[model samples]
Target: MSQLANIKQNIDTIIGADELMERIRAGKKLRIKLGVDPTRPDLTFGHLVVFNKMKQFQDMGHDCILLIGDYTATIGDPSGRSDTRPVLTEDEVRANAETYLEQAFKILDEDRTIVRYNSEWFNEMSFGDTLNLARKMTVARMLERDDFAKRHASNSPISIVEFLYPLVQGYDSVMLESDVELGGTDQLFNMLVGRQLQKDAGQPEQAVITMPLLVGLDGVKKMSKSYDNYISFNHTAKDMFGRIMSISDETMWDYYRLLLLMDEERIEHHKSDHPMVAKKHLASSLVAMFYSLADAKHELEQFEQVFAKNQRPDDMPEFQWDSLSGGETTCPLLNLMAGTDLFPSKKECRRLVEQGAVKVNDESVSDPKAILDKPADELVIQGGKRKFFKVLG
Candidate 1:
């Protein structure tokens, strides 16, 4: 495929395609803009969907802008909301913005990226300046947005501040003089607003490219931290691999397409293998993206040992026998597991025990208050499916 075609392949929508192609053909070092509001601390595989496309532009010698929406985040993007979003404090936005680049650089080339906080421009605008910008769009034009329209139709309270979000996002493009703008499909309206704002400013309108939202592990909702379905960048290699593996086989194909960017032909080829085999490959590839190949392989091997073979891992986290129990001859099962980092809380550990999810030395233990004899050797304890601990004397 040609360079433009390759970039266009997996993308959901590309407005002003001819302009984008013309600029690419002319060898223009286009300013590609991807604006993200730092509402969440961690960036997930969902963000990777667009970051991959941005990477393509960077590789082709384009100027990729990672715009941090420190100011816009306080308003929050009302793209798909039924209710008004909770406003974020400046401190909260700043703290979230600080971690974005470090995580974003995992996929984007750090040296090549141009990072800018929207606060640079938004912070300087006075209430009078905001009114002048707000005049550019009528309330009718604002309601043209699908989210706004839906809320309006249902008589939902649409805060006037929410109306400014798209305008604020659009002004970023005008300030940057962006050549190409990228976002999720839900942001199409907001991105187009940017394109229109650029046109009105007598600058060339940006080409809007909207990528599909990555489905979360649940396979229903879009990947989001709020939904608790996202696989974030900070997840450990083991957690990443296991979570990817836990996705339904149907959701696996979407992961292959969106996350891996595998074309239909290659995806079909992989579909010929056993689902388990294909899933493992998918899991390892994603784990390897954030971590090393060795980490991926180790996690894959460990997963197979624990889940497939129902055997304990050789490298399970080890704890000194006394470290968990203060050198006692016995320890309460719930207390022992809770003292270690194996479970999140004592209540959860007790629940696992009550539910028979916790096992001691490969034997199922079902009483939360049950006492265990501290083994002189190593006592292997399995906590749920993903956590394993070996207490050593």
Candidate 2:
């Protein structure tokens, strides 16, 4: 593929493609903007789709402006929200913003990327300035957003503050004088708001490029922590690789197209190959991208050992199993998970059991509430695809 074609790969929409292309042809470095709200401390693979697009711009000799939307996050984005999001305190926003910046370095080059916080200017602006910004967009124009319209038509409680989110987000573009803004397809309206707001401010309007939202491992909803379907960048490399392997064969194509960016020919090549082999290639390649090549290779070896070789890993976590009071053989299933700190909480353990992801002694856990008798020998626990532990009596 040509360079421009490659850059445009997997792009959902580009608001000002011609002008942006013209600028690219001119060989001038453009300032690209991608605003992220730190409503959540961690990013999912869904967010990586946009980050990879920004990485492409950086490679093209353009400047990347990563705007941390500290102020707007407080109001919460109303783009795809069905109901009003809870208001956040300034401290919460700042705390999450810090984590966002720290984790962003995983995909973005620290030296080349310019990070800015909307709170820097939004905090300094007076109420009058905020009011002026709000006047730039009419209520009808704001209603053009699908989510906002649906809520209004359905008579759902649409918080008044929610209306200000896109406007405040748009002001960040004017402040940054962004030449291009990158966002997910869901943010098309907000991104267009940035383009118009910049022009209204007598600045060069930013071109908007939106990428497709990556589907989670569930192969349905968008990848997100709230859905419990997200693959977190914070997961262990082995866990990350294992989760990739769990995705359905069809969903792997979505992963390749959106996250992996394999061309049509290469993707078809994978389809002709064995599904397991293709998935391993995709899994290890993704692991290498997020972590390292060595870690990816080691993880692949571990996966093959457990699944193909039918053997426990050489390095499994060990947990001590104490007999119940009075030498009783039975123990609460939740107690073993909790006592060992195998799970963060009883709730998570219950959830895993309900999902049929928790197993003890190679048997599927029929009941999270069931008490298990003490094993005569070493007990093995396998939770989810990656978590494994050995219990010693």
Model 1 per-residue lDDT at 249: 96
**TM-score list, all predictions:** 0.91, 0.91
TM-score, candidate 1, is 0.91
Q: Give candidate 2's total backbone clashes.
A: 0
- Model 1 scores worst on lDDT over the 10 consecutive residues at 1-10
Candidate 1: where are CA atoms >4 Å away?
A: 318-351, 368-379, 391-393
Candidate 2 lDDT (Cα, 0 to 1): 0.85
What digit string (tens of lDDT, one per residue) describes model 2 on residues 118-138? 889988999999888888989
RMSD, one per candidate, in order: 2.6, 2.8
Best by lDDT: 1
> Which clashing pairs does model 2 show?
none
Instruction: Return the lDDT, model 1, position 19.
Output: 89
